[model samples]
Target: MHCYIVEYRAYAREHLDGRWPTYSRLVSLGKAIAPAGPVELWVLQSGARPGSDYTLLASKMTSTPIDAFDVLPVECPRDNVRETPPIDILITRYCSMNSKAELIALARRMVKRRPLGRLEFVGPAE
Candidate 1:
């Protein structure tokens, strides 16, 4: 199966409740090849805030966009209502920047965008 990479903002109901996205490589020794499972990693945007800026990154199978993510629920206090579907995340790598243009550029490189393999819903890479 082809691997899909996507970048988007992920956040919790509140700033402090936020958790960094993460990645994991599923193991299947039964397979003839070792490490046959996919590798997941987050490509966060620079200067994005916890609950404001869009700085989250995700990757998964080439199915639906959500399939590309390893999401985790955002924990909150009892008074705070839990998010319905929760958020998809693993271990995320955060970049620091001053403008949205810079963030888009970095995201483009992370996904290895090609003329034939453009992202499903992200903005233009040019």
Candidate 2:
């Protein structure tokens, strides 16, 4: 399976109708990754205490175009340390994972050689 990870800060504001705000950059990234095949988009919440585990807010399978009105500006962390890249990939399907821990473990292994960034891809071993 191919996976793409993007960071989002949900604390900054309340999500409207439980939908995650998508950004222009995020949509572009999704387009770049969609050609490979079905992809899992892991939404990792930022601002967790250093050394603490990451919070997986949501997971979606993106392979659709997003409405213009649904797009929002890039989200910035509360500390203002850095700006999170905007991601607005339309969720075509919802991914049901066995457990959060399982998902995280897979993410950890995939990203071990390449640290997570704004938008990271974890494909089959090269």
Please state the error at residue 88 of candidate 1 in Å.
Answer: 34
Clashes of 2: 4
Tens-place lDDT per residue, model 1, 18-112, is 45533322221111111223434343223334543333343453444433333212222234233444346643333344555554344444433
Best by TM-score: 1
- Tens digit per residue, CA lDDT, model 2, 1-126: 323333333533344345553321221212112222333434343333442223222123544642211111122223323334545764332233354454544443342232223322334322
Q: Using Cα atoms with residue i matched to residue i, what is each candidate's TM-score against the true structure?
A: 0.24, 0.21
Off-target runs (Cα >4 Å) in candidate 1 are: 1-65, 70-94, 113-126
Worst 10 residues of 2 by lDDT: 24-33
Error in Å for residue 66 of model 1: 2.2
